[model samples]
Target: MPSQGKLYVVGIGPGCEEMLTLRARKVLESSDYVIGHRTYLNFVRHLVRGSIVESGMGREVERVKMAVELASGGHVVSLVSGGDPSVYGLASLVAELVYRNGLELDYEIVPGISALNSASPLFGSAISGDHAVISLSDLLTPWQVIERRLRKALEGDFVIAIYNPSSRRRAGNLRRAMEIVIEYRGDCFVGVAKNVCREGEQVLVMRASEVAESGVVDMHTLLIIPSTESIVDGNWIITPRGYSRKYELEVE
Candidate 1:
């Protein structure tokens, strides 16, 4: 009997080949089977040689089950995800399936840059200060839970990075989010980055009020709501804590 192969949930990192970590590349290169959404697979198609298993959008449960089955049946499998696999990716789902199905297989999660990380640099590190990251998609999670987290983050005055802010079928979540944020911090700074680290990227720096007024964000856009201390310097928006002393003159 042939030895069963292990599984790896790999993060490809924000739709860019350069952003893919060395370890993720190695795992994909060694795998005999690769599974992921078509778009994610396209991002790393040149880096690996394997039988591809493409998952349709919103079919995460099926994808996880298939990847585990392949790995348990003696095929080294690589489950690819955009950005960090553990962050809004297949890591948790795969682990859950393993636990429920009693599949004994070795697996590891390979981390990669998330869209939030990629967007931060473009906006002058808007997330440097305390912040909260949340996903606005309510497919798997209830709206009440999402709203509760948003309210808590607002009360804490933490900068916020929100993912899946809107979609064609769910166009009003971003506007609602802005309304909630405004109730706590009126006219707060807000930055939106679409397709970060990829071609055709768009970045918008504006106020939370403006975001609600404009109504232009979508699921691809990553929204950053700055705290009270954030400031704009020309094209860059940053949150500085008056730490100039770290770079100022020394006492002579």
Candidate 2:
């Protein structure tokens, strides 16, 4: 088959049009079809002049397949995703599908700020040092593997940024992980940002033990467990870059 129109997998960045990257906005504006999850599609609905195709939860594969099929039919399709498309988003699936099906189509993965990035500013510099971005969701990855990774990250004393921490069906997952985290770093300072960069945005910073006790976290929250070395100065959190204690800065 002859080559088809380009497929731009654009990341809209944290459910806000203001946070959307310039390149991502341009790509979506020029696309012939905008495809994404219902939540993500709502973020870019005002910008999409083309056909808006959305899928329900647990229908990620269907969304990808539809985008690939549409682009294969010579439509300039924009596969929209919240946050960076390459980070646990739809870009990888789109690439994999195109490669496996031997589809002839030009495509681009436009990068955007991820949830962690959006939540970072709210927690000061807690992630200024080396940190691991781990998703607590075991829907795709096994729980055992996720536990192993958590253990390794804890052992390294690395700052950890957790995504998809909890949901209605998997409420105990975050609690279980918190147990492991406390065992390793019981007093580790934790910063939880809820609905980051969107409405109802709130930032809470407290001890890991508090997070383990509280049940406020949900799918929309982003958790940051900074190393024991991290300092909590007044209302700000900071992970120093080998700087002297007096030189450590604090900002909102």
Query: Per-residue CA lDDT of candidate 2, range 121-183, in tens?
Result: 787887886898899999999999999999999889888999999898997888898889989
Error of 2 at 138 (Å): 0.6
| Regions of model 2 farther than 4 Å from truth | 1-3, 245-252
Query: lDDT of all the models against the reference?
Result: 0.85, 0.85
Worst lDDT window (10 residues) for model 2?
A: 243-252
Residue 123 CA error for candidate 1 (Å)? 1.1
State the displacement of the C-alpha of residue 164, model 1, in Å, after optimal TM-score superposition.
0.6
Question: What's model 1's TM-score?
Answer: 0.93
The residue pairs found clashing in candidate 1 are: none
